[model samples]
Target: MENNSIWVGKLKKLEPSDYTMSILPKLRIHEENVMEFLRLSASKPEHITEILKMENNSILIGKVNNLIFSDYAVGILPRLGIHGENEMEELGLLAEHFEYISEILRMENNSIRVGKMRSLVLGEHAVEIFPKLKICEEGGIEEFFMVTDNPENITEIFRTENKNISVWIRKAKKLRLENCAMQIFHNLKFQKENVIAEICLSADCPYHITEMFKMENKSIQIGKVKRLELNCYAI
Candidate 1:
């Protein structure tokens, strides 16, 4: 157990459980009292100590834990200068409050950019926040790999029959599926700069660019050729 004296300057400076024990009780003292104490707890640790002295520490900690990860707590975290509880939970909240988030709210944005598969499906505004390729990679409508926000920009040409991915990207350039990107090579702007060299030099991408590398023409290359695999082979 840590000395509560360490929490004299800022409640956020302490671990979440400790801070929750110290501050939730004070804020929860009044049923109407909500996030007002968050600002104070973040800025004045002595004030927190005073309140802690009056709380039933064990009871407060228990109660707070029961609600700390609830949706209500998600809104309060940003106010208290906290971002999230952990990687997965935070992503879900951030995906919900996409418009209000900034780069400073979190340390890493890579995983968040692609978003969890579940979030990409659920994020109502996810198309606006994530890159087309990233959104597709995370799980997106097959054909909309780029932007077209206005009504005038909506063209009858791209609207395919049934979310069924029928060579939409191939007709457009590459191929996309009903649910995700088959790959991004046909985006033109992001085509592989050295795919042939990378594939010839590395075996990891054996079928990734099979047509361009002509992996089927074993006479042109030399190696222990293994069985080919479909993208959805396991499924």
Candidate 2:
């Protein structure tokens, strides 16, 4: 009998004890019935893990992995609970967080650009990856943190969705902030040739502001800035 011909009404009769390879994969299971589906497929833990690798199924994967590691043929499924655990460890394959994560948040080396990743902490190596990463209207890097010296890198990171981004510059060779809106520069050792934007230099802005304006008569275009706050000692 072909499994596909079987009605969805008959799914209740299917049991883990039956142990039929063909039936499990063909059945269209729902999230509510995932426990039964996992049990029916427990003979092959690899299959379950592979599905997990492809889908971001949530805390249920972690619980199932624990059961599999304990040598249970098919662990009993209690009422669905939010364990708040994302990481899973069966044969020690899951990572805390990897560079690339699609919907499933697993380690993938194919593409450096993150697909549906939400919270990712990019280190010094991020500058190289950001340029190649595509900025789309859909899922993108929500929160980004990096310490880089190059102003171009800073610009690149902000080019994408600029929601929650923090950048620390050791020093900028060329500081250009024209037409920048609502940007706060804090405790920066800046050396530039021009400042033509309508900006507000407040607090610790140098008393020797004239030195910063020693331009070479070259119009270094910094676009338009609505307001710029220089946070330093009293001016």
Clash totals for all candidate models: 2, 7
After superposition, the stretches of candidate 1 with alpha carbons farther than 4 Å from their true spots are 1-127, 131-185, 194-230, 233-235
Show model 2 residue runs off by greater than 4 Å.
1-123, 137-146, 149-218, 231-235
The local lDDT score (0 to 100) that residue 40 gets in candidate 2 is 34
Q: Score candidate 1 by lDDT.
A: 0.25
Give model 2's TM-score versus the native structure: 0.23
User: Which pairs in model 1 have colliding backbones?
Assistant: 169-174, 170-174
State how far residue 215 of model 2 sits from its true place (Å).
Answer: 9.1
lDDT of 1 by residue, 1-235 (tens): 3333232322221233324635443332221221212211123233244343442222212101111221122223222312122111112221223323223234222222222222111122222223221222322222223221221221222333211222222222211211112222222222323121111111123343333343234233312222322333111
Which number leads on TM-score? 2
